[model samples]
Target: MLSLRTRFTALLIISVVLVLVIAAVITAWLLRKPPEVMYDRVLAEKAEFALLLLRADPLAAQTLHITIQEKPAKDRIDQDRTDNILAEGRRQGYTADVVVLKSFNPHRWDIAIRLDDGRWAYLDFPDPAPFPYLPLAAYLALVAIGMTGIATYVSNVMMRPLRILDETIAKIRPDGIIHELPETGPMEVRTTAKTINRLATRLNAAVSSRMRMIAAAGHDMRTPMTRMRLRAEFVVDGDDRQSWLKDLDELDHIADSAIRLVREEISPAAQEQVSLDAVLRSVAEEISETDLPVEQGAIKPVLVKGAPFALKRALRNLVVNAATHGLGARVSLSRYGGEAVLTIMDSGPGIPQDLLGRVFEPFFRVDQARRQIVPGAGLGLAISQEIIESHGGTITIVNRREGGLLQTVRLPLCKPEQD
Candidate 1:
């Protein structure tokens, strides 16, 4: 399907051209033979005047004896065609009922008129082409060019509002920033913009509501979670008690992560210009301090608009996840096109193809049995994704073909992707 602007512009051009062509055809049809008929009428009148002069003087009629053919001169002036020509000349107010069309040369007219005095008069006159052909062709060419210019101007006027609406929609975000489109165009355009704004408003409301609910639930669970932890301390020193303590600890961590996710969603740190290279390096240094085999590649300082703390947390999550599961990590930062890209490659056994997607789901673990060994509530990737997306970015993880997993994060260098 064509876009709105393209469709409208095409239709406008076609309609104007079609109208011009149809109007020209109709005008030509109505005007086809009138000019030729008028010329024939004038010829008959001139021939009659000459006959009248000869009738006034009998000697002159014999002296000027002009031959008149009763039969047509040739096939070019047959009886039927001659009759039709005579009828047209009479219709144009000429006394041509008794006039005979004798011959029609290329640029000459020859007609015979029967006089009131029982004499025949033949008149010969020069005839040029019926209409101004070359001039009219030039005129039509100018008309076509003018029509094309008008069509383009009208297309721009009709589609200006839609262009503005599209550009505004492209900058939409979930960060409570609602850019209102101009509602001052045609009625349909204004209505469309209003509908989009209303949808954005409802989306913001829904997100805020979810964040509040999640934050409230996590906060309310903290008291009971602490009480449960305190109660676990009294259990006998055995495997069962140890398992109970571990489960409690996991629950507390999950509840804390829930609140953290809600906070990041609802009130992300204010966006500011920050060095993307610095953020990645900071996360790499912290991971290296823990004796993890984390390598930070040479990175050029790239500036982007985002919340520094939230950005760092997301980078750290990817780095830590790689170090934990992939055995080691290599972090690199670069600018690609209009975006800043951070890549984390790990050298562990790659995640199963089927489980790579589920790894980002909250509480989803690729290797469930490994949970007992590597302690985490499984919210790292989920939280990281939410944070990156909030800052107008995307995070993706795919297994490396060689032996490990690769995670790539791309953040827009300019205004975030709101659409």
Candidate 2:
């Protein structure tokens, strides 16, 4: 389906051009008949005026020098001839077109005028051909050309505001900062922009509220966490003490993850041109330091438009999550169509079928019963999805047939704006 802007432009331009074309056609048709009518009127007037002069004085006919003859000398074969003469003449103070006659030349028009003495005055001349069609066709062609240009110009002017609206709406996202729409253009366009700005204001306020709650919760937990850590220092060294410290450490990890999530949501790094291969290689190199058996596949210099740090963090999160569950991760980056494709595969046991779809939810954990295996909260996949999607990308995780979980991320290659 076409977008609203596209539809409007198409409809507007087509309607205008069609109307103009129709008008031009009708005008051309009407013009064609007028030439024939005008010629008949002039021919009748000339014959009538000559009849009037002769009726007043018979010698006036012989005195006339204009080209009128009882029989044209240019006559050839009598293939076409008339059988009547003055019988078709009009006597009601006006003259009609001349009547045809048998004696008239076959190739020329024959006109008969009734004189006062009840005699027939025969006049013959070749018919004037209808006006040539080329000029009329040219006039219509010019009209069509002008109509096309006018329609295009009008459509562009009208669709300009809607194009701006589309661009503004596309740029709106939870990542980075919210930018207001430009309240300009036509009245309807200005209204639409203001409405979008109001909606953005409401959305930003909601996000701010949630982020403040997360920040506050993280802040409030720090003092108690510190006091608990200090108290644990007095405990005697034992397995139970180790378990308590581990549990507290996990709680601290959750708080820290929560704070980072809120901070990232509030302000992801600004977008810029960055190399996808570079970010993937850097993240894989750091993960390899932990001896996780991660491999960085051959990557090209695929420059993407996004925040480099945010993308790096997203890649790191996917790798770290895969490493924690699936033993280790193998990372690779490549180009597909107009998108940058990033794949992360892990060798550990993949998530259960029932929990696979829910893994990306905030703080969702598949291994709830195996908390000791992984101490962090279940925000890694969720955060990674947020980061990727904010940059106009998609992240999906599926279990590989061979083994382990496979995550695929695809980000659209940004195009430059035209001047």
Candidate 3:
């Protein structure tokens, strides 16, 4: 599909060309007759008039500047132009032989009319140059070029508002933050910017309200959870006490995860250059102490700009997720282009293809059975995604063809000065 600016410019050029073509055709039709025909006819009429006056009074005709000749003038006229003059003279009822002669001056023409007494009456008259089609074509081409330039300028001016709108909208962050647009330019542009600003204000308010509600609910749940745990400790039967404590512990984990997820959404932590290889190695070593199989491979020093603690937490969640769910994890870090690329591979069963898209959704799981096998609320992936995206990074999960799952994380590398 063509853009609006391109379409507008093309339409304008086409319209101008069509108008020019039509005007040219009309002008050509109106001037179809050659100027020589009219010039010859006028000369022929003057020669005839001079002959009539010469027969009546020779001296008076001589005073009229009529040059009487015994034979035709030596100056030659073009055959086609002579024929046209003859035809025109015949149309005016003069069947006598008529001859048109060229003059020494290009702007004058002489004509000879055979007199009744076998003499020739010669007369000279002004002539005009023929109609110019070549110059007209050149003029039309110049006009077309000028019109094309004007069309391009007008199209750019008209589409400026839309271009500005697109660029401003692209700057909007995924965290529901809206940057106000400058309400300048034409009236239409100003009105559009005002409307977008109003919509953004409402959207920001709604997102803030929701985040606050979730954070408040998570914080409020901790008081009751502490009370329930204290009550669970006093249960008589060992099995019942254990069951109650386990349920309370799960509820506590859920609240903590919920609060942390909300905090990840709202946190604007300061960022600095951090070594990704060190973070990966530390996570691997810490997980290894817990008897979780996490092997480091191809660890390369890569510096990226982000909060060190947040980056560590996100990486740890991914590593722990793979180790716990996918049996064991193999991690690698390297610099690819201007980005730090990290890969986590595991040997356990991969997620179903149908449920892969929902992995980033909060509290979403492949199946309810995993909820029993895995602990805490299913917000690890969601929180990690928020953290990664906040730091201008990306994370993706895909089922490996051989077996298990592959988790890939890419973060833009910092400048050499930051390292």
Candidate 4:
């Protein structure tokens, strides 16, 4: 699983790529239009002027013909003069076409001259400078590169704040520690950063306050619990004493449950690399010593970085719960992909479908025939979930089709298989 910062960076890079692609597309569209269109328009207007001059001074036309042929009419047009004509055309937003033909028939020329007055005028000119493909292609390529660079720069700039936000959020611990996000970037981005930081602060304060209250309550109740136990021991009658002792034991159980709940909620980070197989074997052995029909699978050593004690406690809770409520308990451990999975199957009646999600909540128990049969404060699954989650893992319970409850715990593997 990638960290939030890495994921955000990847998304930003993809967005940059997308923006660059769009910019490249728009640049290509703008660059693809023929460069010759402007040149042709300029030439056409010059040809029309030349023809009009010829009509005005017919004798001058012969002199101009000698000069025009020696220095082609296209060549006779000055560079500055052509530029001025194009600039003027742009100012007026007009488009013209110029075609020059060499060694043309006088009759066809006359027809073209007559047509010029009628709007079908075809001024044929000699092939102008070889198609300007090299310069046009170079210009378009430069434009594409510039556009792509700008797009990439803007994308990087836009992504910087988000990257910082992601990094800040990733630093937040599950125990609800808040890390402030940087308040920078565009107006909208700055607003988002402030909102996220405020949310984190609120959540942290809420979780810390709740955990402190639970811890304080659990701590305060222990002295009263001890005093009550001491008082219960002094009951006179044998049956009455036993009943009072049982009540005291129940009170002790309640105190233990309360303390365990608070501890799980405010657990400190104590993760380390541990062998999953060893932990499972130890749990199975302890359970088997109690005469429970607990079976073990062909175990492989799977290394994972996590709170080993918490994991063991979680697994033990599952096994004990199963043994107390189900016909038998069977535990299996295996590696799948980059994760270590420990599945504990029991022959107990499965939980109701609707209650499966609620089973993880503290003190939530399913109402069923076996509800009273099991001795629990309903915190077993909740504790198990807390332990697993603290180790960056998950515990899920599902009904087996073969008629039982199946609890699967998945922990990320620390050691990957070498190919």
Q: Quote each prediction's TM-score.
A: 0.70, 0.68, 0.84, 0.65
Error of 4 at 215 (Å): 1.2
Per-residue alpha-carbon lDDT of model 2 for 337-356, expressed as tens digits? 78878888988888899888
- List, residue by residue over 1-419, the lDDT tens digit for candidate 1: 88887788778778877877787777667646456566656665666566667568756755767664353445534465456556765676655343445454767776666766555566667775555546666776788788878877888777876776677767866445567666666787788788877876787788788878877888898899789778877888778778888988887888888888877767878889988888888889998999888988868668889988988888888899999888999888887777888889988989898888787788888888988888887889988988998987888899888889989998888634221
The parts of candidate 4 lying over 4 Å away from their true place are 1-58, 66-172, 237-243, 368-372, 417-419
lDDT of 3 by residue, 1-419 (tens): 99988999999999999999999999887876556566667766765666667767868756877676786645575556678877887788755567767667877776677777787777777665556799889999999999999999988888888877787788877576888888998887888789889988998889889989988998999999899889988999999999898888888887888888888888867999888889899999999999999988899888899999988889998999999999999999887778889999999889999999999998887778876667768888998999998899999999999899999999998964332
- Candidate 4: give the clashing pairs: 44-98, 99-123, 99-124, 99-125, 100-124, 100-125, 100-126, 101-124, 101-125
**CA RMSD of each candidate after superposition:** 7.1, 6.3, 3.8, 9.6
Q: Model 3, stretches more than 4 Å misplaced?
A: 33-70, 73-84, 101-110, 115-134, 416-419
Where is the poorest 10-residue window by lDDT in model 1? 68-77
Task: Score residue 43 of candidate 4 by CA lDDT.
Answer: 58
Task: Judge candidate 2 against the unseen true structure and give its global Cα lDDT, from 0 to 1.
Answer: 0.73
Q: Which predicted model would earn the best TM-score?
A: 3
lDDT of each: 0.76, 0.73, 0.84, 0.69
What root-mean-square deviation over C-alphas does model 1 reach? 7.1
- How good is model 3 by TM-score? 0.84
Q: List the residue pairs that clash in candidate 1.
A: 172-418, 326-348
Name the TM-score of candidate 4.
0.65
